[model samples]
Target: MKLLLTSGGVTNPTIRAALTDLLGKPIEECHALCVPTAQWGHPMCGPASVRGLLAAEPSFRHLTGLGWASLGALELTALPSIGRERWEPWVRGADVLLVDGGDATYLGHWLRKSGLADLFPSLPDTVWVGVSAGSMVMTPRIGDLFVEWAGAPDDRTLGVVEFSIFPHLDAFPTNTLEAAERWAADIGGPAYAIDEQTAIRVVDGHAEVVSEGRWFQLTR
Candidate 1:
């Protein structure tokens, strides 16, 4: 699968262009499946937040509102009961997955529980567009600093990607570059700190930063 891991959604022309290339077509021609499961695990998220994503509210214009040919919700939490036969086709039919932000560990848990993780190997042509925790879920460890879900056993995730991510860099009072460095030290691994206008594109295990804002490699 192609990955466009971002702190924010596709916020700039460059990031959007990268997304288009990954889709191998115009955004208007692509079909998208949005996953809002992570929001359920976050203290700050609630019904209103989930509604915004589903409805493509103005604030979510960068993600769900990106004007795909069609958009549908694929709530990972519900997949276990529905059976893979029903949901698997839904996933494979979409051109991209627009995964929203919330709690990474929680998202990771449902991805496995919903049997979606098992499908990764079969989805070589799928484009994964992940935002914040959605992006962090691909890494090995998000560090305790980013773990907000009380149910998570530890600061760990799927580790689909080799490196970790420090998202929302400088967007919040607590997400300064110095804080990211400290977080990197706490985790002690290869990691990146990316601002709202930045993203990390990964394809076939190779990664490169696409940024119109600040970003840094925090560990050697």
Candidate 2:
């Protein structure tokens, strides 16, 4: 599996280029499916905000300019009427799975409940691009880093990757790099703290940090 986990979406040439490289094709030829389930997981955030966020999303504009075909949030898990067979093709056929950030616990629940977790390993050609909570959903768990960012920690994640990610480091109202580092210190396994300018790239089973911004990893 190929994963480009970012605090923010594709916001720079370095990260953009990394995504294009991972796609192994021109951006124009790619078909991307955006999943905004995480944002909806928040109690205060509504669908209007989610729509507004996606409508003017920098990453959406960035990719569209680069020639990508954006499928916008499918909302399959959100809508109960849609069966797996109906949306499974869309998930399986997409060139990229663009996961938007919001509440990690909320998103994690849907991923597991909706059976998306089982689909990750089968998506050999799909590049999973996670933004903030989207990135965190792939790990073993999301601990206390977010604090008041959202609901409680589900801890149980998709497990597509091993390390937990703390995104938006040093950003307002969220985690600062120092606090994140301290949180990582308590984590028993590998974890990372990254800002909007940073990303964690994972190919197969190996992971590496790619950044134009500041980042660090905590290891046992």
* All candidates: TM-score: 0.99, 0.88
Candidate achieving the largest TM-score: 1
Output the number of the lDDT-best candidate. 1
lDDT of 2 by residue, 1-220 (tens): 6999998778788998899899998777888777878877765567775775557555345332345666655663654467778788878788987787777777878887787777777887789888888888888877754533445554556677888887888776657777777777766678888888888889988898888988887664
lDDT at 97, model 1: 97
Candidate 1 pairs with clashing backbones: none
Off by over 4 Å in 1: none
Lowest lDDT 10-residue stretch of candidate 1: 211-220
Flag clash pairs in model 2: 28-67
Residue 210 of model 1, lDDT score: 96
List model 1 lDDT by residue over 1-220, tens digit each.
Answer: 8999999999999999999999999999999999999999999998999999999999999999999999999999999998999999999999999999999999999999999999998999999999999999999999999889999999999999889999999899999999999999998889999999999999999999999999999986
Model 1 alpha-carbon miss at residue 65, Å: 0.8
lDDT of 2 at 196: 86
Error in Å for residue 174 of model 2: 4.7
The C-alpha RMSD in Å for every predicted model, in order, reads: 0.6, 2.5
CA-RMSD of model 1: 0.6
